[model samples]
Target: MHAFIVTGASRGLGYALCQTLLDDGYFVVGIARNAGPALEGLAARHPERLLAVNADLSDAGQAAASVRTALQQLPLPECATITLINNAGVVTPIAQAGHYPADEVVKAVAINVTAPLLATDALLSATGGLPARRRVLNISSGAAAKAYPGWSVYCATKAALDHFSRSAAVEQEGAANPARVVALYPGVVDTDMQSSIRGSDEVQFPQKARFDALKADGALSSPADAARKIVDHLVSPDFGRQSVVDIREL
Candidate 1:
């Protein structure tokens, strides 16, 4: 059996991933703050396969601990692989570095950087020896590599996640049941997050026009398209050959 634990699974790419995984007969534990109607429909269709967990990832420690306990308790059958996709993230507080509210800044850090790292540790400890191929996919961004004027917090958090993958991948390599980790950059997909980007205050995000143009020209990839490519890579034989991947490059 293949088990996939996905965050932000209520909608967008995360939801698409859950659907795709279930269609292929895999078990999915979807972690979402507000497990929306779409996920509800998925649960209705695949009752035995999809488990939606309602937990806000902003409280990273609590959410991680909760999922760890839940998975450890479930009667999950033997698995070929157990994959964790850290897809929950916030691209908010879009303003110059010093101008963001303290709370928003802290919240973004928790959701973007802290949550994925904690969940990675939690999954490794909880899954036991059931699956030999354990993999972690941290949803990162190009902002991690190239800085944007108003995306200080977003860029920094993604960079932290990417660096964390580098260190964790090496450490996992030596463990008894090592889990391969990759920090992937899923290019500009037309998710609600992209909508938020387009709606940002232009004075703060000067590059908003580029994203606007991308939308106007139909350049953004759909969530389903991106999710399919991502899942294909996740299950491929050479899945973890690299610690970082950009879907566009694939």
Candidate 2:
């Protein structure tokens, strides 16, 4: 059996991914800040196969601890294949880099970049002895490639994550227990994050208009549908050492 771990599973893409994985018969361990109604419903449906954990991934120690706790929930003689989905992310209120609050920027970096790296490290270390195909999937964004005037912090963090994913993929290739590492752009989904961006003060952040257009044109994909596509890619036998793939291109 295959076991997968997903972060930010309380809502949006993360929650959708959890539901898809459970339906596909994979043992899933989902982490989030709070297990809200959606997650509660998922747990009730898959009591034996789904393990829901609540933790703030923005805290470095808490991020690492979440993975350790999930590892403990796996069946004894742990499954031969393990997948870690670093899907949790944060988009602070839009503002110029200089005007953005220091604490908010730090929190965004922690959740978007630092936490994912730490979580992947902990999972790889813990599963070093397991005889399974190991995989790490980093959820990236288009912001990593393009620059938006008001989203400096978000763009920087995601760009950093994209490069980190490539570097980590290279390292995994040479490891004793090689794991496939792929960073993917999951596309913009209709979620609270989008609303936050759209509702930002247009005076300080002029890009709110673009976000509004995106929302109005129905460019936003459904979280559940995007989640299904992501899980499909993760389990594909032909998924090679691409390292970086944009869902838009696919």
Candidate 3:
């Protein structure tokens, strides 16, 4: 059986990805801060195939442990194919670059950038090498490319992740059994993170217009639909060695 690891699987896109993978008959190891209601429902449906691990990816040690638990649950010997979906991320409250809290920015970098790299390295070590047709998908955001005044930290971290994914793709290219690494931009979705950003005090940040427009235009994609598309790309024959692809283009 093929095995997949999806981080931030409690809700939003991560939860959707886990559910979709389960439907496709793949064993999934889901790591999240807490087992939210949506994930609890999924676990009830696929008790054997789903392994829910609660870990704060921002905590370096916890992040590494989560990957180890996932490996233990789905041994490399038993599953010849493995996929790592670094989907967990955080969007700090909208604040001007100079005014943003240092602690919050640190947490954002730890989870959005450092944790994914650590998790991928742990998986590679545990598996000994890349699996046949292995793939590592980093969930990124359009913010990585575009600049929004109050979202500096969030944008910077995602931009770092995108760069890391591209560089890792090149490193994996020469491996005896290479893996395709792709940084995927999932687009804006109607998620809790959006709500958090929208409800923040705009007077201090003065950049609520973008959030307001997203809500007014109903431009958010459903997590389930986005998750399906992400999975399709991961499993596609032509996934090839491309280092980056925006979901909007797919």
Candidate 4:
């Protein structure tokens, strides 16, 4: 049996990925600040296979503890593989760097960068003796490689995550039970994050028009579609071959 851990599992890509994993009979630990009705319903149907953990990713302590708890209670007798997807992120404080709120800046970094690293560290320490095929997937974005006027915080955070994956993968090389790490760009999905981007102040986000056009042109992938593509890559033999990947390139 496969065991999976997903963060930001309340809605959007995270929720869809949890549902997809559950439907395939995989054990899933879902961590979210709030579990919406859809995820709650899925949890109800598969209580044994799906574990729901409530944690605020904005809080570093909560973020790390959630991973420990998720791994601790994971039924591991038949688990053959374990994958951790750090999918929770914040695309906020959508204003120019100088005008950005300090609090929002901190929150963005906590969610986008620190949480994933902490979660990866926690999972590594907790699962050291589990002897399973382990992988850490950081849900990244195109913004990691591009510069957006008002997304300095978001871009910097994602870039940090991508670089972290590269370094972690190297560090884990040749270990007895090493875990593969990859930071993947999942493309522009029609999630709440996109909606928030569309609503940004034009003065703050000059590229708002481009994103608006993507939505208007019906080019954004649906959450479920994106989730499926991502899971396919997650379970693929070629997964983690590239430390940093753009799903669109696959």
Candidate 5:
């Protein structure tokens, strides 16, 4: 059986991705702070295929432990492929760098940057000699490329994830069979994060009007649609052709 480990699986794109993967007959180990109603419902339906792990990805120990728990679900000889989607992220404390809370910055870095690295490490260590194809997909954003006035923390974390994928790709260049790592930009999806951005203080987040306009123009992609597009890109022929990818380009 094919297996996928998806972080942030309780809601938004993560929840949609879990639903899509289960429909495709893949076993999914969902890691999230809270296994919400959607995931709980899916678990009820796919008892054997879905494993909901209530985990706080911002905690280093929990992030690593979640991967270990996922590995335990895939017993020897039965698992065909292992895919890790680092989808959990935060875009908070939207203010000038010095004005943001210190603890919030730390939390953002922990969840958005450190957790993916720790999860990726555990995945590679556990599946190194297995015949299964390993793939690490980081849910990145356009903020990684452009500078947003009040989103310094969010932008920096995404940029770090993108560079990490690039370095991982370089390290796998000569391997006979290497784990594919790609930082995926899912575009502007209509998720809770967008809601948070729209509700932020206008004085601090000057780009609030832009997000509002996107919503007014119906330009935001739905999480379900984004999940379908992302899943299609993940299974595409040219998946690992580039270490950094934009869903629009797919």
Candidate 6:
């Protein structure tokens, strides 16, 4: 069976990805801070295929440990494919760079940047010798390329992730068993992060109206739809041709 390791699987696109992959007959390891009701229902329905792991990725040690645990959960018949979706991210304390607390900035970097880096390292290390098609998908955003009024930290971290993907792809060139890595931007999805952005103070986030208008005009894609599109692209022949992908283009 194929094995998919997905972080932030309690809700939003991460949760939808798990549901979709499981439906397509892949074993999924879902990592999240809390085991919400939705994930619990999924686990109850597919106990053998879905493994829910409660972990706080903000802790530096948690990423590697979580990956190791997920690998242990793989059933017999071994794994034909291994995919790591670094989907956990946060946009908290929305305010001007100077106005936000230093600790909040650190926390945001920990969750958005540090965790993914560590997780990727662990995944490659654990699956290096396995004769399976390996892939890593980093959930990135448009903020990585565009500058937002109060999203300095978020933008910086996502840009970092994109660059990391690019460098990793280059490093994998000519390797015997190379893992395809891509930083994917999932357009504007109607997730909890959107709600947080829409509720932000106008002074801090000047782009609030744009996001609010996106909701009013029904422009944001649903998590399930976005997840389907992303997974479709991941499995496509052209997946790894580009280190960075914007879902809207696909």
After superposition, the stretches of candidate 1 with alpha carbons farther than 4 Å from their true spots are 36-38
Tens-place lDDT per residue, model 6, 1-250, is 7899999999999999999998887789999888445588888878888987878998979977888888877852478889999999988778887888788888889889999989998988888888888899999998999998899888998999999999988887767899999999999999999999999998999889999999999999999999999989988889899999999987
Q: Write the per-residue lDDT of candidate 5 for residues 84-117, one digit (tens) a residue.
A: 9999999987877778989999999999999999
lDDT of 2 by residue, 1-250 (tens): 7999999888889989999999998899999888545487888889889887889988999999999999998973768789999999988847786698888888999999999999999999998888888899999998899998888888899999999989988888788888888889999898889888888888767878888998899888999889988888889985545888877676
Q: What are the per-residue Cα lDDT tens digits for candidate 4 across 95-118?
A: 897898999999999999999999
Please, what is the TM-score per model?
Answer: 0.95, 0.96, 0.94, 0.97, 0.97, 0.96
For all candidates in order, the CA lDDT equals 0.87, 0.87, 0.84, 0.92, 0.90, 0.89
Worst 10 residues of 5 by lDDT: 72-81
Query: Model 4 clash pairs?
Result: none
Judging by lDDT, tell me the better candidate of 4 and 6.
4
Q: Compose the digit string of candidate 1's lDDT tens values, residues 71-153.
A: 76456567777889999988988999778889999999999998898999888877756645788999999999999999999
Best by lDDT: 4
Query: What TM-score quantifies how close candidate 4 is to the native fold?
Result: 0.97
Better lDDT candidate (4, 5): 4
**Colliding pairs, model 3:** none
Global CA lDDT computed for model 1: 0.87
Q: What is the lDDT of residue 124 in candidate 5?
A: 85
Which of the predicted structures, 3 or 6, would earn the higher lDDT when compared with the native?
6
User: Which residue pairs clash in candidate 6?
Assistant: none
Model 3 per-residue lDDT tens digits across residues 1-250: 7889999998889889999999999999889988545477888899889988889898998887899888887766777788899999998846776687888888988999999999988877777554545778899998899887788888899999999999988887788888778898888888888888888778754678777898899887889888888889888886745687888787
From the highest lDDT down, the ranking of the candidates is 4, 5, 6, 2, 1, 3
> Judged by lDDT against the true structure, how good is candidate 2?
0.87
lDDT of 4 at 117: 96
